[model samples]
Target chain A: MSRKYQAQIYVTLRPSVLDPAGVAVASGLKQLGYESVEGVRIGKYIELSLSAESEADAKTQLDRMCDQLLANPVIENYRFEIAELAASV
Target chain B: MSRKYQAQIYVTLRPSVLDPAGVAVASGLKQLGYESVEGVRIGKYIELSLSAESEADAKTQLDRMCDQLLANPVIENYRFEIAELAASV
Candidate 1:
């Protein structure tokens, strides 16, 4: 039988890519008197749940999902942590 | 001397709040044939670097930053992980 799993995926822009949005936020923070803040980068965080026969199966599917849709491989990198969920009562 | 620290912050909508953007993404994924996907919630992932005297100091500052700017208290919640960086030459 299949088991439930939850994945916390983080998608970030490659370091070489410029993040204007992050810069804007940094400036905003500076204006608010948070002068110590530096080098801010913003990205996408996705929480997804699915079911698979095993942990290996879930990981393989998640990797495919990230490569195909969750992240733009050309300019973004993605990583995720997966954990099996307790079976529902 | 102060040391560098990195903070990974995740901001997500409260469960009771509607997530239209997440719904759109889930539907998009479904169209792409990932039918097993469920409870897809999209959130903001932010990476920030700063200098602080210690880990506790960094954590305190990050908490204030999130409260004031990074997350909305009304509809969203935020949590973070902090790592101390080696001193630069």
Candidate 2:
């Protein structure tokens, strides 16, 4: 029998890549009187729920998913966590 | 004097809210041969950099930011962390 697992994957653009959204947020903060505002980078947070034979198996699949479709190797970097799902309330 | 800090904010939909994107992702996973896949939730990962007087000030400001604009209180919940920025490589 397979056990369920969950993870949160965060993908962010590489530092060298230009981020217009970051610039906009910085300006917004400055306008709001957060004078010390510096910068912002927006990224994707994907929550996944899946069933796998083991924790290792879940991570392997997640790594593949991130590399193949979830993240852009040239511009974005991705990281994730894997854990057994707790009983739902 | 001000200190530089960074944080990541994660915002997700309340379970009751209908998530079309989540549904689509779940289906996409199934098609990709991840049959044990159950569900998916898509959220936003916002990385922030700013200057604050102290860690407490940063947390207070982040909380205010989330309440005012970063998240929709009625349908979504948000959380963030506050940390000092280290020297960049």
* lDDT, residue A76, candidate 2: 98
For residues B15-75, write the lDDT of model 2, one tens digit per residue.
Answer: 8998998898778777877787788899989998877878899899888777777788999
Alpha-carbon local distance difference test for all models: 0.90, 0.84
lDDT score for residue A42 of model 1: 99
Report the CA-based lDDT of candidate 2 relative to the real structure: 0.84
How well does candidate 2 reproduce the true complex, by DockQ? 0.73
Model 2: runs farther than 4 Å from truth?
A: A86-89, B86-89
What pairs collide in candidate 2?
none
Candidate 1 lDDT, tens digit per residue, A1-89? 77889999999999999999999999988898878787899999999998887889889989998999889999999999999886642
lDDT of 2 at A64: 80
Clashing pairs in 1: none
Q: Highest DockQ: which candidate?
A: 1
